[model samples]
Target: MNVSLILIILLVGAFATYLAGDKLASKVALLFSIASLGFSIVLLNQYNLGENINFINQWINQPNVSFALNADGLAIAMLLLTTALTPIIIYSSFRNEYKNAKSFYALILFMAFAMCGTFLAADGLLYYIFWELALIPIYFIALIWGNGDVEERKKAVVKFFIYTLAGSLFMLVAFIYLYQKAGSFLIQDLYNLNLTASEQLWIFLAFFLAYAIKIPIIPFHTWQANVYQKAPTVGTMLLSGIMLKMGLYSVIRWQLPIAPLAAKEYMYIFIGLGIAGVIYGSIVALRQRDLKKLLAYSSLAHVGLIAAGSYTLTIDGLRGAVLQMIAHGFVVVGLFFASEIIYRRYETRVIAEMGGIRSQAVKFASLFMILVLASVALPTTFNFVGEFTVLYSLSQINVWFAVLGGTTIILGAYYMLKMYQHVMLGETNTKPFADVTFNEATTLVIIVAVLFFFGMYPKPITDLITPSLENIITQINRIN
Candidate 1:
């Protein structure tokens, strides 16, 4: 079967979930998500065996656009992350009672479908369509199901919508220009263009605007904390865990390849911006009294490092970025899930309102502690592998970049450990804080297991992504 099969499954699953009505929505969604995951596994096996899984067909003849889904090892890795996490994310929400549950779960599946399409689309216009499609579901999901004041949530969601949409238009323009120059919107065609250095610089800037706003690096990150805090936990997980990676992945897959000269020429500036985000996000996270907001800032820090690694134009840098992206995805979701669990018991997001939970819920405390350590990139955790590789790559460029980027681990450890102590330790809360239920424990255990397993044996992922990353690196240095 072709790569499009996975997309079809998720798309149909969204409709099936909505038709199942509110009562059966979660179960239906989870079942379909698992099916998609299973299919992806089968596809992976086929891919490894040298079967043709890529799909492409003419869509717009005049514009020369094609509906293409290229399932190379890199795309497959991202597709697997989206498919695998979709089930966990859906099952995790089984604990909460959302109103109009059918629509909520349907939106989740639809978003997953769009995200998978984004990862797989090999045509520029087609990829843009999927990219924008992913935004619509999340907008409604956050605006409708999100917690907090109505006005604030609306403002946050709307602003995020406008910011990302506005930035994306610049990318669309760049694509249109490339289509005119190359007479095709295919990725490989654009990659083959012999543009002037000036053209590459403008195109590079256009893409940087879109990716920066989405990745929300530094000054462009104003909307992130508010949106993260206001959106429901599910939306937060989708955003921090998977959606943010879209931008980072695009840098490797689209931006650098299309404008290799610009990427190489201005590498240090972009890397500096990413490093700035690292320092800024860490310092801000240190002061956040709100747990989700703290996690949100923490995400900002991690992605910044990932971005820096991607821009380094080295195999280690790109490979490390991909590894960290996957590692961060699972750990961040687990951390946010921990917050949701605490909120369930106490119905509060304020760190001050939580205390002595460890005494009452030993299982939860231990799991949350593992997630925290994973976040700070503890040795033997998946995060450490990625972080060490990224830091090493940065050092290859400039030792000081490595030193500054390394603050994420140091400041990250201090803030996360301090957060865990205040929220889980000290005097027991008067309210009965029950231990994690079977479902909750299952989700965290799965995430933790993946982290530790990959941390020790990352050869599989490294092997999967390295060749693709090396090709991109070759493209970046082709002129040199």
Candidate 2:
């Protein structure tokens, strides 16, 4: 079957599942998710080992928008990540009793559709539409089903929506300007269009705002903590695991090549923000008593380094950033799931509320420990591979820059260990927490397997990214 047909079927399956009653909704959703995963694997197999796939036809000839879908190594990698995680997420939520199970499953499936579209979209306008489309379902999921006070959840959802949409509007305007100049919305056409330095700077700024808000860098990151705190476990997993990567991916795909000179000239500004986010997020995380908030800040710090790496425009930097995006997604999602387990047992996310879990629940404690180590970039974990490459890239740019970026590892250990000690260690002050169920254990084991597998043998992913990175670097050098 054709890949596009599979995508349409998956979308339709989601709605069909929604129409099904609560008893069968989750099962149907899981079936569709598995099918999507299978289809994505087939798509990966169809690619000529190291080539991209593009499907294009005319949509609008005048302003030059096309119904275009393309997937390179990067897009395929992200697609696999999305499809692989959806089933896990759906399975993770199996124990819960949602108010409207059908709608919940529908939203999750709809989110999958939007995310796939975002990664596959080749036309500028088409990409934007998919980009914005991804945000709405998540907004409702968080608002309707999130934890915390009703007012607080609403506020958090609104803040996240407004911040992201505001930046995206600017990005839409930039795309329009680029269309005016290039007479086409095709990504390649935009790349080929020569524009003045001043024009590039303005367009870069516009695109920067959009991705920055999504990435939730310093000053623009106020919404993330609250959103992460309030969101349901699945919602939080989707946002941290998949949605944040969208911004990082955009920085590499749209920001750099579209305005290479501007990126070069303003590299320091981004580097500065990246470093600031690192320090600021770390310090804030150090003070966060809530597990979710701490993870959220740590995410900011991780992405800061990624943003800095992208600005370097070096092969190692870009490759490391992409790798780190994948690593962090897995690590953060695992950590968040760990938090959910604790919350289910203790009914509180406050770190200080519980202790002595290690003795009572050895498996849970062990899994949490492994995830924490990964979060802090331990050797033999995927995060380590990504961080090592990124720091090496930063060192090439400047030793001090690498040093500044390296501080995240230290700070990461400081907070993560502290949180672990507080939550998983000490005297048994609370009731004995139950051990992880088979399902939960299986989910965590899968994540750990991928984390270590990628960490040990990063060559496949590295090879997958190298060709595209080479192409991007060639363009950067020519434009420079």
Candidate 3:
């Protein structure tokens, strides 16, 4: 299938960049990422034709595993997110020089390959393999090339790695049991399993642990802020932009359909926990003084709402969840990259240490302001579209659910505007604050274009995603 070619280009590009050496690694990586994005767009065009992009091959005899990759609309949407962001990630990093540049860029490409596989794999066993595969490069990316104290960074990255990997074990057990029942690791076969409520409850819990920890729900999110604060900017963008979506995507693709009974039964619990994260993240972000940590919490708040949307299990909720995910991917990366921009210029991330950037760097301040408002979900920004859809979906379930989650509208504005005022609008700081460079401007411009373009005209995305989500709802309802 054509999707396999996309993976091939990424895998080969990873090694090719390493071979290209430090002198040309970053350029090579950027070129490859752009090419990957091009191919992903091609895949998107072919999606409506109902082309067979599913490729199956023998992998393991004992587990009955096969190498299967399929590109449905859901998978393609995730792929678009991955490929679109990779070029921007690499381009943004062109401003920073990392030691072992080849390995660094190569790891980025390898991570893309793994994430693409995670989205495309049609076999449950294959998906599990790729799921674990996606974690390796980010670990080393943050461990070796990351900023902050080495020992502390080590602890943070290790905690993040172990926490996510540990949660994945429970999911493996669920997959194994499903294999025993279905005698096939294919996703469709697992979806067909007639699980009793007891089995669905246990299986749902197993999947919930994995997705919850990755999404870093309220209680499971201890490692998130530290990791985001400590990791390199490129690493942070990947983690927040695409990797976290992996968890949310799993809920739509695997957890809900396969465990329809438990999902419907315990929908309130997922919604409650997700809503709790929304408030908890907002209140904590209100007091955060470090810029990156605040954005980390902001990310928690945004995704918390996305998680709530998914738990609603309606076409509207699921649609809003996926759309918001794509929206947050662009917005969060821009916001985090903005922090990186400030860190490089002012040599500080402490909010109090930064002031009056706009007095000198007017253009940078203006762009930064747009992202801030977008994160706050200002009307006429893409974030508002997703936020409105999700809140409406929640309201349909229960008005109070909408009320609790909607507090982000108020608190998000408070924290984000407060940070903007402190970082960009206060009286002039003594330190030199420069405007964003050409490459940095290019990245931010692309992100802003996507946001506002979709903000005013969201029909294309909603049209593409609605049919698939409707199909998912149909499968889920019929199963129960």
Candidate 4:
């Protein structure tokens, strides 16, 4: 229950950031985010000693739902990822001067709160509530503050809002079905339900609709590139870095376990869909002319591989998916932030419009190159471990699946290298390009350092996530 302290700090931080007003909002949010990270690390220490944190309060009676939260190995690992990213995200925003700074920063903290709740919630209704709560702030963050033409922004924002919301409705229906069957809204209770094959398939698809739009496998991904391009850089970072993982995490925590029979019955179909996204997204990314949109497609390819891994329903696959989730979260934020840094100086995002910036910004170019390499799953980068594991998992499923998914490595390198050459190498831009400022440098340094450190030594995180994933696989296999 004491892990409730983690959520408490984030929620209070949101309000405190708002009340602190424009002058101190970002600073206050940063402080609170750091505190949240510190507390989560402490909790992880406790978790190591065979301990967990769970909090419950009596709430709804008709549906038999309660406000409940628990931090197990899997939950805490995600919580750690959420809390860890919040401060880095806030710090990355320090150089920008946001209009209505209090509201902007407050929304960021609010998002952190909701996302943390989603990760920690132990009850089905509570998780769903937190899940929906996350969409509100991001909507405003994009709508009020997005870029491009106002009408275009509206179209993209509304499309994104409607798409995700519509997906959630199906999920709510599934949760209601589970509630009826189990007579309780606790996740474990739903997991134990003895639903027949047809019911499991229906429930599986319902959850899949919700999560697919969010993780956005293949065709469901139309909303992504536009939103990433239009939204302000911070919003883009949030969406790519942490929000997308919500769906992937749900697949592991809720969808697969609750409907294992259906999941198994359709495993190949879903896995094939995920691999398709990998190939389709990578192919599309190879053609994108805009920086943000290109990264958006790149993200799609990466997550597709991760999803394929999770669907494999094996220890290696699930472990790789979790590790890759964390890795992708970090690298994408760094990549998008690099784009933001360039936009700040050049006032453009078109790849053709940018060229040879390394002449002036050696430090920036080096860091950007590292991130680009990491994105392509370069050795000695954290991404390699995740990519290798996911591909290995897919190989176990079908060698061809791994071969198809592995195109990301080739295509990722093609686009990323082409990007780096056009944007940073060759003839220098005629205009003077300034080097990264202290704050920008600080952010990039932290990102690169973490990527390298974990790339070298991944055992800590792998160990942390394995036990929970093992138990999950056990639940999944029991259905067979």
Candidate 5:
């Protein structure tokens, strides 16, 4: 009934999948991932019924940290998103044959375990440990199973490893400093600290350095495209769909609450940076010839807007960011899976070479088009609900912020549609490109179903997250 059960399931599943051998690895991983998703639903029901599901126990007494896993509505929402997408990502990989398949599938479940812990952990040190643990499996996944030249892949993966690791150290330093002052690493304890303006600013900047690099907003985004292009499709899916949200989630859960003054003082500056990322990512995506790299840039742009929303310090902003986090997670995974389907058939990711796919693959093109529309925030799609709320929040701050952030719609539609034109529309391709099979079609259908269903009825999500977000706003406003 407690949150630790989900973590235990994933950890045990990782080992079970590995032992099942290459022949059964994918199936075992999928089964376990689905089980986690099912159990997450059960926990959600318990939470709705007002049962206590959070776990906290004393650990590391000298530093006064607890082994805490808190499942507030916001954290549960994120946990559900992580759990929901994991099986789809794994299922999407079933068609491709991987070397060392056992390890490949095992790592996917392990990464899920780490990400779930990251979402649930309520102690700062525990959260950081989970955050860093999520990185290790992805590093090996990208370095071993990724595409492109071996040397080039190594360079890209290593850069990502070093870049994120270094940024995280700053966050660790911030945590250590806070622990010194507060004598405990519990989130509630840190949030209660009334630090001076200078202290808050330093802490804010330290946390910003870590999150901005992970979120990779604008100037800190150098490591993104290369890694996305080099990593395998499933690796890319995990990074884009679930991992990127960790930074934005932390901004809401930790940064703004703990350093409300600095966040308030420098709000416009940080929001400006996020808006800048939106414009930059959109423009760069227009120029990408490789499909994955283009999608990577598009992801950067979407998260940028989400980041800007979180900084707005309004319930609308934080809630919209969380909603968009879930929406973007599903859409981006679908887009990448669509590309992977093409790569499997055409054996090329080059946009110049792909054309007339729709003629041969009606179902795939249809599903892909829906995903593209969702990505561009077309009305009635889940993305539109999130994107519209985020823009509205930006507008309340400054019309110009809203104006510039709106460019994602115009530019996004341009590049995404244009990419679709070249890749899916045109005269029938000379080469044979098969349509997606039942497995592939099923995956895309599930994603599309979730998007449309939520798009029409977002109340369930809004209701679940609103109170938690309001509490965060109260905390952020408490000292200031």
Candidate 6:
């Protein structure tokens, strides 16, 4: 179960492929991603619940940090997600030609390594290093491969980089302060440090700003729509599918437990903001004309619910939030990929430019409809299961809050269905577009299969997450 070895193998494969030549670069990336996925599954099979696995070697003596990597149930779940998506993203991008295919595929592999590191790193400094490392490959991927007005694309990438980095600085300061107090950068060590309410308050605030901006809740979310809209579909998939989860994961693993009293005292304010973001994002999404922007706003709303669920401080709430995080990652990636398929055919992203696609592309329409229904939290879909659990948990806290948060369903349906009607089912106004190609069909079918499979049998995932959620809640209660 040495996960570091998995990462090393992926990087080596990627570099070797880079030297192999442009024609083989994508194939190499796909091979690496597939091998990584297999390794992740093996690691999952070997994991013991309620146990921490750490690999450590001293990295810096002065800072008293090590190259620490650890995983529990939660970390394993995230690792599964990162591995699962990388191959799909690589495969999805294969039809397009890149001038520097080797570098492009290499960067994608590098991003996977960074994401795995972010999930597994056990020391605060190690986590921060991986956290920052994840952004660099994405920055290049977007800046080099993105679409839209060239200047706008560049501006969007820069804005995303600066905003996330700025928030991360606050988190760095919080980590340094904790290290100064606790004399070590290990996460578990900091968790055991007893700090005053005031100290906890500031530390919590620092971490909250970092995670919030990364999650991009409400006002902090200004950079996301542009970034999503401008970045290449692969970059968008990684950002929405796996990268954003890093923020939510940090909140559960690092923020709440490290500052429980502060979290308890300030739970309402945090929950309130999440509630506000949910409603606001839904409303804004309803008005979006571009497919990517629409999906971006919708992602904000989904994350808001997850945030609110976290603040509920209830076992079911946290469990549902974790479930929702995984569910949303899959659903959103499918939605964006679906949109990319249409964009490839029509050469447009505007909803008005699309119509009557269902007439020519039944497979595309059917899959798109299923994904849209999933996005709207329809029953027999994983989204419904996740949202229902979160809402039920919220009901235990405050019925009014549950109702408010649940309005996302109505808004989500309104916007998603509107987009579907405009894009998939209307009078024919242009030449019939070609049906989905084999590669596109294969990608969408796999996404659809996973969506339905998880929707029908969510127990395995729920069971895997429940024990970890219970442990976290137990700690929160002990401190509060």
TM-scores vs. true structure, each candidate: 0.99, 0.98, 0.99, 0.99, 0.99, 0.97
Clash count of each predicted structure: 0, 0, 0, 1, 0, 0
Candidate 3: worst 10 consecutive residues by lDDT? 45-54
lDDT of 4 by residue, 1-480 (tens): 388899889999999999999999999999999999999998999888877567888898886988888788889889988998899999998988889999999999999999999999999989999999999999999999889999999999999999999999999999988888889999888878888999989999999999999998977999999999999999999999999999999999999988899888888999999999999999899899999999999999999999999999989999999999999999999999999999999899998888889988999999999999999999989999999999999999899999998999998999899989999988876678899999999999998998999999999999888988988988898743
Error of 6 at 158 (Å): 0.8
Model 5 clash pairs are: none
lDDT of 6 by residue, 357-376 (tens): 99998888998899999999
Model 5, span 1-480: residue lDDT tens: 999999999999999999999999999999999999999999999999999999999988887989999998999999999999999999999899999999999999999999999999999999999999999999999999999999999999999999999999999999999999999999999999989999999999999988998887979999999999999999999999999999999999999999999999999999999999999999999999999999999999999999999999988889889999999999999999999999998889999989999999999999999999999999999999999999999999999999999999999999999999999998766898888899999999999999999999999889888888999999999944
Segments of candidate 5 deviating more than 4 angstroms: none
Reference-based lDDT, each prediction: 0.95, 0.89, 0.93, 0.92, 0.95, 0.89
Model 1 CA lDDT for position 310: 91
Q: What is the overall TM-score of model 4 with all chains considered together?
A: 0.99
What is the per-residue lDDT of model 3 for residues 302-413, given as tens digits with 9 covering 90 to 100?
A: 9999999999999989999998999999999999999999999888899999999999998899999999999999888899999999999999999999999999899999
User: What does each candidate score in C-alpha RMSD?
Assistant: 0.7, 1.3, 1.0, 1.0, 0.7, 1.4
**lDDT, candidate 1, at 445:** 100
Give the Cα error of residue 42 in candidate 6, in Å: 0.4
Model 2: lowest-lDDT 10 consecutive positions: 1-10
Predicted structure 3: lDDT: 0.93
In model 1, where do residues sit more than 4 Å from their true spots? none
Report the error of model 6 at residue 476, Å: 1.4
